[model samples]
Target: MGLKYIEPIKSIVLLLLVLLSITFTLSIWTYTPRLDPIEQSPTVDISIGQRKNVKEIIKPYKFMIKNDEFMRGTTEQLDIDQIVNEMATWKITQLLRNPVEMNKKQMNEFFRQQNQFTLYFQGDVPLSVYDEILEIEEVNIPQFSFDRLVVKWNPKDISFEVHFLNRASGIHYYGRVTPIDTMKSYRSLVVGSEAYKNYAEVLQPDGTYLAVSNESLTIQKLTYFQEELSPTRFRDALFNDPNAVRRSQVDATHEEFGDDHASMIVDTDLKMLNFVHPAAETSESIKPSELLIDVIDSINEHGGWTNTYRFSHINPSYRYVKFQLFTEGYPVHSNAKETTEIAQFYGDDRVFRYIRPYYMLDDPLSEEVELPSGVSVANALMNSDQLDFGTVEEISVGYMMRHDPEQRVYVMEPSWFYLVKGNKNWKQYTPEQDGGEQYGLE
Candidate 1:
């Protein structure tokens, strides 16, 4: 028995030796690339006369505050709106091809260039023609707008309000002058200032929190159910009767004032899906990249850009995303309400239920708004009685539905939204136009 025990021990030692040999072999086989020796280049000494030619860097513009702004200049008030609009349109084009860093592109549709351009100008200032401007090393497109254009004298600062131009109304942007050094490559800008970033955060008593148009959105409106649309289509789908049930279904129940987020779209079951917030945490969180891929595919299969749809809110937390059809970059607000909670899904995480509004050929911008300054809007929020002084986190500028009773559809208008901490419902602050002139507009 003792001899057998010694033999077993000897076998164990042999196994250990084998393992050690394998490890040594692997260590030898493992390739570690050695860096090549740095060849020392001989340094050529030169006097001042023999130095390399240095091109004079002429800074076209300098940042000086005549009115607490980055740069201000006078354009002879010659169609500033048109110039600004063109610039904005160009920016929109650029956005399609190149989205800003961290911003999600819902569709993978390559936006083809229709027209070629050599150079464009704002006014007397020959702005720099740059392919990109970035926070780090990528072009940021969300920091621009042409919705509200203003040309002012005295201080001689031209105001070009920068809002993200998608179907959905984007954040109310701040204004600043173009950087002087960047003037050569800078286009007409009032929004994305190098000195000051457009504040997207909710205004607290202490200060403002930075926010984006759509961030941490757990819900997304992937392709919607496009059955056919008619005026009585909703009526026929909802009830056999058009009197009480249809009336309640068609019109907003809670809203006695402006347009409510409520809109009734006929689902595939031929039932009306009233615009209601999707239930929380329906499914576990899924990858947004995978979700976006299906969205783009569906949009393409649906006759491709048949209707220019843009992301309304791509909240991917509860793994939900929503997109609205945009007509000429104006978001169709009520087209697809957040009824994905009960709507039918394509398979596991794809949504197919959304309201299909009648697309018009002449679908232009619903309204041109003169947004109040971030400070003024904050003041209004502080003055509001309905909203509690809770820990407000984010503030975004985007389009909300306004009842267009005449056209029997919801029209999108720019509005300020405040996301109170831990609350999903955005406290909206819209400027009440009492026929009196609102300050901060030209």
Candidate 2:
């Protein structure tokens, strides 16, 4: 009897275990992971006809009447009937999921899925008028489509300025303004030249009518408008001739080198004379006196003779004559080459005379030489007091001899020296003129 009872209990327990196993299997087939309260639930598969109603889907969430502030607002005091009527008028039906509730990963997936339904509105629009409509208290959304979301609102508040751009073939359509009635329903139609036969209708706010086609037009039209405008001085100058001179007339006095003047003078007495030699090549044999004579002769021929002075015994015993050589008649060449050519021509014939000594005249002598108004010459030698008589007496004599190779005529320059007079004080005399008269020994 004990064995019979134990067998029946064992059979009953085995049967219960079998029933439990079947229940577990059925639960496994139907089970879905529970989502965190903050996390979006996983999407469940459903046939097209069995999709959840839009109202039922949004019923749990609070409907926000979009105020100026996005997330915060006063609780809508309207009754259900009033709310439904307002929503219907605005054509609003569905609520978009709040972006704040989504985590990074879920938000990314949602965006990926929702990007297909999002609408993009892009164009040039004035900001002032659009701000008024965007301040509305509430708006409604209506039926939705899977491929794209269609929303409608009254766009009465939108304002626009239209512009046209000429193209090679057809016209383009461009809308400029924010839609006050509908946010996502309105979109900027990017009409290309290939798609439209004429884009002229899109150019202005109220001009012409545009035609739409399905030919897959790829034409792109661009219109540029400047808000703040200014005129450039260069452009104004280029377009208009405001009495501007084509060639300016410079004053004769303002011209450079036009009134330049210079003169030659003997360095010994700082007197204005026609002749002056370069003190650099001076020698005892080529005395300052003789150099003075030669320079004076060259200046006379050059036509710039302003004044001349004779040397007198009253002024120190040295017999020196002074004169000014004017640059008024001096030859002016166009360039260095021309000047050099002229110099070479005079140099070959021993006619070129150095004008250094003349330019070295002191202030008193320079003043003596008459010059044109507003013209002056520098006295370089007056500042350098050292007389440049040659070092070697023989070289000086040789240079004087070579001064006129063609003529073969040699002349000794005049000089002054003291001679002892019968054991008394020395007296000076000109070697050429006085010979030895004033000198007692001679």
> Candidate 1 at 67: error in angstroms?
14
Residue lDDT tens for model 1, 1-442: 7887998899999999999999999988996879999999995321111111101011111111112332322111223223333443333221232233211122101111111111111111101112122111124433222211222212233322222222123222223322323332233333323233222334345433222321221111222223333434333332323343323342442211112222344332322333322321145554444443444443333222324443333344444444444332222333233221112122243333333333322333333455555555655555556455445544444345444434544345565555565444454556652222222210
TM-score of each: 0.36, 0.13
**Top-TM-score candidate index:** 1
Q: Which stretches of candidate 1 lie over 4 Å from their true place?
A: 1-286, 304-307, 314-319, 325-361, 364-371, 396-398, 403-414, 431-442
Candidate 1 steric clashes: 28
Q: Where is model 2 more than 4 Å wrong at Cα?
A: 1-104, 112-116, 121-131, 134-217, 220-229, 232-442
Residues 1-442, candidate 2, lDDT per residue (tens digit)? Answer: 8887998899999999999999999999999989767977895321111122212111101111111212111111122223222223332112332333334344223323311111111111111112222221225221111111112222353232121111111221222323334322223211111122221101112222111111112211111121111111111221223233132223431111111121122222211122112222221243332333343343343332222121110101122222212121111111111110101001221332332211111122111222211000011111223311111010000000001224322221111222121221222222232222332211
For residue 312, model 2's alpha carbon misses the true position, in angstroms, by: 99
Candidate 1, residue 219: lDDT = 18
